[model samples]
Target chain A: MDRFRLPAGVRDILPDECARFDAVQARLRERFVAAGFRFVRPAGLEYFDTFAGADSPVAPSAMFKMTDRDGNLIVLRPDMTLACARIAASKLGAESAKLCYFSDVYDFSAAGNSDREIAQAGVEVFGEAGAEADAAVIGFAVDCLEAAGLSAFIVDIGHVGFYKGILEESGLSPAAAEEVRACINAKDAVGTELALRKNGASQRAQRALLALPSLFGDAQVLSEAEKLTDSPAALASLLHLKQVYALLSKAGKEKRVSFDLGTVKSLAYYSGAVFTGLAEGVGAPVLSGGRYDGLCARFGKDLPAAGFAIGMQRVLRALERDKEVRQ
Target chain B: MIRVALAKGRLASSCADLFIRCGIRADILKEETRKLVLETSDGAFKFFFVKPSDVPTYVEYGIADIGVVGKDTLLEAGADLYELLDLGFERCKLCVAGFAGVRPDPARPLRVATKYVHTARRLYASRGEDAEIIKLNGSIELAPLTGLSDVIFDIVQSGGTLRANGLSVLEEVFDISARLIANKVSLKTKAAQILPLLAKMRGELAAKDEV
Candidate 1:
């Protein structure tokens, strides 16, 4: 008889790995509780519409879906943010809420670092739209990471609104905006400039779009961003980042904060302040979150929201690599 | 210090030449030796000479800060790394070929064999052709000759090997060249050092019409 094979992208956690994972999760729960983020364990399966938020990047076709007995389509939670939004809107309506979730998100995307089923510990701040909220979650992320025995990490912060401002002022169609965003996300400056020109974007918009891929580095790059555009929204986006950075400094975590003006988040729902946490040795980001004020509106309630999820496997991988070096 | 994984053989030599031109002490890289790794006399950089295909793997895993490998290997492996620059050496073209004058049956799914499974699969998909890709480690050209596949998707240089194998080029897919790729983290934390090197290389490459 042949040994049973697990499905592709599936891994049976061995005893030692499971123990280590449990310990990490315990520590995460402790820190999250201390930070006043009430825990909410959302269902493992959600409606297909939940994961597909406004302008969501989680393509429905790439999701694992099945029809329930009533013929309503169900899907594994490809993301927890939408589920959090649903809960905040339905049960905890019209009130400020700070919710945290520890769940496994199923990502059926094409082959990459994305695990088919990912173990994630995430936090979502509801009813707060200020830059301080962005700073608080980021500081919490750093706190959890530090408590986990990881060091030499920086949180890369970006703003979708910065580019969105340019597109809005340019009056490009939604399709054209997507094309421009995709090209910029790929860091293909030439392609983006050509596309913008072909879409009849103004010279200012074209120049700013071209400058985006290189709009990365320390806080000083914020000043350099002034050259991108003079639109009030673009300027306001810069000020928003400045405010977040100032709050980060107030929290004394400014050294671990960097601005990536060109970085594009995978989800289109990020209304402001997108960020990813990158460690020194890890090639892929270990933590990713952003402010998505529009997601809750999909659940028929309008509330400002921002949250981020930490990849448990990535953290473990980095730790294991650290162990190998020490040994 | 910056560490570079230079793909062994011809690409390594070309990359070493470029590095030396950029004021980097990379002569230890071009010397005839069986050593797997070497460091420049200046001690500012370390060079690891790995198999041509393993360069990207090392860079992607952060074992080395940067790598010099052909675009074909980068595409096939699809390692997560920053493709920083194109060194413009070891020029070749990825082409599809089979026994001369043989017409591929359009009614059936084409049996394509090559070491570059991802590249070939993408090419077939782009052409809207269903293909059964057969992965081979060595002697990929024999698949078509031995009736194993209807076509072979392989890199062609000067058409010498295809002519010797009694095969003719069917379609030219695209060009391939060496690229300078960096570990994502290395690009961020070591930008102070790596960016200067990249800028210098770009400047030199622009100045020189020839390697």
Candidate 2:
């Protein structure tokens, strides 16, 4: 039995899991199609560079690599959005287009003992620039979770520029700014204050950094955030969030959303709004996506884009947890 | 209604004392108990004793709503639970130690020994130093004495153990203290219960400090 060990992090998805997971994936795909997103499946293996293209690859090391007959080093797709983005740019051209995918992304950060290959479903809306475009995708994300019968979750919405607004004015080195972001993510206000002081940030900037984490709860938090910083980019980001909030509110999906000006996207290419969906029980996000207005340009097409991917296993875990609690 | 995972040794005893101060009955634990689960008289909470290292896993996986464990174990475990509050007990430091008056040979890849292999490796890696880490169970001091490794990384309290072993501190990595952590889900859903318990314990700690 020990000789038959699976490779590190690989697992067999048994029939029961396949049935449950497939049902959820199919429903989400149906939702995407009804929303006018044409479903697309980029090849399972791409040149490693293609997966690493535009956005830094999500799980580069975990990607199963192979040499093709032509001797090109190919990588199993590590993220669906990166593969989808390439399609939108190369095939769809500069046209404003919507795309969706149901795929598996290979990564080594699951359960610690084995790498997890995730079944991810997502949509990328390219060539949309305004806050309305941002709201549409975010609203779509909320609806998918709703269609899955998830009520105990939140779509934490944020703009990368809100963080950028402070970093640009604080005059901290990139290293120091990164430290501040880490502290903010940890919600360690004391740590953020000390880092700001060490970095010689202005008192106003320090004040904003300290208040950033708390800017998470309600639509009213945006107005509260304005009192902390007067930076133009920061203010514009807040207004963009406010307008997006108004749209969700009009759709009566506002309660499912919250804003965090201090949100940090570890992914580098996020150009505008960034959002994560966390359910009531899971500590990690089940859905994460953001606007990468700068991403398509790397593939030779300059276009605004926003997209998100839901971790299918995590969503199922949440659904399972919900089922147990209800029972 | 609530379940708490408590580290089953020194941290557990001190935490029981703290919970008592906060007026939560925990005497059932002090009575030479092997009982893994004990319920409070009113049955408002259930307490379960687990190994210190497993505390975070139990909490993070939602088997327990909350846990109390050392920052050292928490850091090494790297579990993704919300560190709700610092209980501020079991104070110590995760320090890098070596023989007194000895300089590490930078030319050779660093060789170290520790039970905390992850923490030790990360400590070296963060400094951009290449090091081989020998994992040991007890008496990490024997590693340096036996010449199995150049140095050892472990928790140091009051500098007593290091001095007794003729070891000197090279760098104090970070402070370690007991922290109260909560499952991500439990924190949101069971807040009405967990918050009051946290506030009471926090109040007890603050008042104790004032004395």
Candidate 3:
């Protein structure tokens, strides 16, 4: 057997790549610090139950599991946001804190265009709420990508409340809603229609749900979506997003931001506006985060929070593509 | 420029025609040339002709901003991308085929042979059935003919080949057709270029539907 070979989806960084990686990390560290975000290093390993029990945002199969010395189950930290939230709530001893981390998180089931060992530079703001906080986090995401030397990128934003509101009136079961969410996330109108019809969704709900896939673009999408539903929650989410967009526009960050009401990620913990950083030369989001107001509450504190994590390798890939395109 | 990966041959030609209808300078696709890559005179688009299965890999890696491939290939590769539209051409059916009236015994795990290993496995697993999927690159019908497997899972545009080989479709699975896909990141980053093309394609498809 070849002992030198690394596992699939994992990579060993050599000197050249390591140098680039370190430079990106250093730049992000400076940015986080200057922004009043305190650094925290959560344990690399934690009890599996911390992320696997009822109402858990993460799936157990997505975690790399192992047994501790005491015969209890443990996992190789599959997510950074959950760990930071745990610390901020259970250990930080503060009602509000802006925490940052440069951490490597592991995902066992990551395949097909995603890495297993992900180097993530992330920031989580605890005890913050409202459109201002959402805009600041998204604008910072844009700034963070710029700091990492990306010439072009956009923070595509959305809100979970919009989807939640539509689903609330759909009369579909929770399982059916999750199925439709996956379909919508993939932008598979075919599958979405199949799932919605199979679940006997109302005609109005079907039209609204079907339109979700196309409900992405500039701020005009906010108005287009406004006409789709009268659900108070969905409308309120749109108003909040409008307020956030206005703030961003006033700050001249409008060019770097766009709205995608269809950006409903599978991360069930997200409570408010969520956004993903998309750039040229990368097929996936280079950065992802959102508001998870109830996450800290799960960790024994009820602090409204929002933040984002940059996929270090994807950012580097985009940089490499930039150089290649230039030459 | 919007980069597109086309599955060489019929799919590529059909996509070229669609692009022409949408006002893209894809006339070069009709010429007889040995080149693998083709760029239009206006330089608004570049086309890469590749193996049918490699189309998704290119789009998923962002090497190509968008791609046109069969849903069957998409199911097998299972690459992460946005399924933007159904081109409505190259229609076919993924089916489970073998000798007529022959059913697998419930006691043993049925052995199936096909190039679509992943799709086959998923089909059976979802139904709570045990299936031993045998991967064969070509001539999947030979597996059932030679008794190497009980059935073959493959795309069937017509029943001529199966009928001549004394085989019949046992069950129809997924409806296979050519689909337009876009990279998740490219859809947003290049929306100015890609979205307009998508709208035009939709218009073209709508016009065709009316006809």
Candidate 4:
């Protein structure tokens, strides 16, 4: 193999890009430290069993796995949140902790404009549960994005419970629910409708499920969704979002927040609110996080948590795109 | 301005007609032009005429905020973007077509040919069928006739081509139609612009369905 050629999905940061990368990381570090979050660097490699299992946030296929010296399976750190949760639950020995890191995570399956080795700057708040905590994390996301110098962006929020609530009414099996979730996530009404019908979902649930794809945009979305279902869990999810939205508004971060009940991620991973940061020129999310009240429990402790990670490379790309638009 | 990547030819014309009905200044789409990029007179929209398959790539990268492409193209490309609406035109059926009464041998794998290689492989695999898929750029029907494959998998608009070639649809896999897709981020950041246009399109589609 040519020594000059590197493997696909990995790249060297040139001088210009490295300079910008440093600047963004510096800004995010300052913000995190000022906010009382302690810095932590997780091991670059860890036992594969740590992230292996159905409830793991990182998909098994997404991890770079290898055999360790002791013949145990190990993997590159594939997700920052999981790493932080491990640290907080097992090591912190406290009820609450705020931890931050500017680190790179690995994704074996990353391809076609997505990096395999992703540089992420993120913070995780443990032992905090409820809407206020959610809003605070989201507000900080907006603040950090601004601090990183993104001129135009919005934090789109959602709850897994909304979709899960409707699914409770649908009575579909877990596999079928996952299929429908993928369809809704892609906003494919046609696919969603066909799947619901084929699964013999009840008419009421079908109606609510069909509307899931189009249920997005401002605070009005919360009310619009409220009329669709009577499921208490779903309604409670909306109420939680309303509370978070109100808190964000109180902090003058309302304009930076939007709602999308259809942004349904892995229900097994995120317990409540989920969000992604959207910038003017980027197609994919630059920032992503959610409330995972259930993650720490899997690591031998019980703790409620919320946090987010900004893809430093994507943020840099967004800044470059913003400049191009301005020019 | 809202940037749109439109698949050239019939789908583009149909989308332009739909846009016109929705109060968009899409009359320029009817004009024959050597120009690659077309802008609306009001400067509210910009259009890029691209190949059907490339529409998803353009939108997925956010080079185009939204795109109008056929479901077949979308299934094949599988680009990560939001499927917003069903444009309900350029309708067709994706099917497995082959000579009547001809079946794959029990001993060997079934051979299929089509441009939609990914969609074909997925269809057969999901059914737990072992099949050799041969990808053809065009003239998919010729594959079965030339003994290149046992069957052809492709979009059937009226079954005219398949019938003319002494073939019939063995299995209907997916219903194909033009769909409206948007960049995920664009759907949020440009909601003010995209949502209103989507509302107009939805209204027009509803009216059409009513009639």
- Pick the winner on TM-score between candidates 1 and 2: 2
- Give me the overall lDDT of model 2: 0.81
RMSD to true structure for each model, in Å: 3.6, 3.2, 1.4, 1.1
Model 2 preserves the real interface contacts to a fraction of: 0.21
**Collision pairs in model 2:** A9-A114, A9-A115
Clashing pairs in 4: none
Candidate 2 residue-wise lDDT, B71-167, digit = tens: 8888788776666566777899988898877877878887899989888777788888889999988999889888899998989998887788888
Instruction: Give the per-residue lDDT of model 1 (tens digit) for B1-211.
Output: 8989987787788888899999999988878998987989989999887888888888877889988888889878867776766677788998989887777788989999999998888878978879999999888889988899998998998989888889989888767888888877777767779989988998987888664
lDDT of 2 by residue, A218-274 (tens): 687899888988789989998999899999999898878877676677637688889
DockQ of each: 0.35, 0.34, 0.80, 0.83
**Candidate 4's interface RMSD, please?**
0.9
Chain B of candidate 2 vs. true chain B, TM: 0.95
Clashes in predicted model 2: 2
Residue-wise lDDT of candidate 3 within B1-211, one digit each (tens)?
9999997788888998999999999999988888999999999999998999999999998989999999999999988888999999999999999998887787999999999999999999989999999999998889999989999999999888998899999999999999999999999999999999999999999999999
Candidate 4 lDDT by residue in tens digits, B8-122: 7878889899999998899999899978799999999999999889999999999899999999999999888999999999999999899989767879999999999999899
Worst 10 residues of 4 chain A by lDDT: A109-118
Ranking by lDDT: 4, 3, 1, 2
TM-score of the candidate numbered 3?
0.97
TM-score of 1: 0.86
Q: Candidates sorted by TM-score, descending order?
A: 4, 3, 2, 1
Worst 10 residues of 3 chain B by lDDT: B99-108
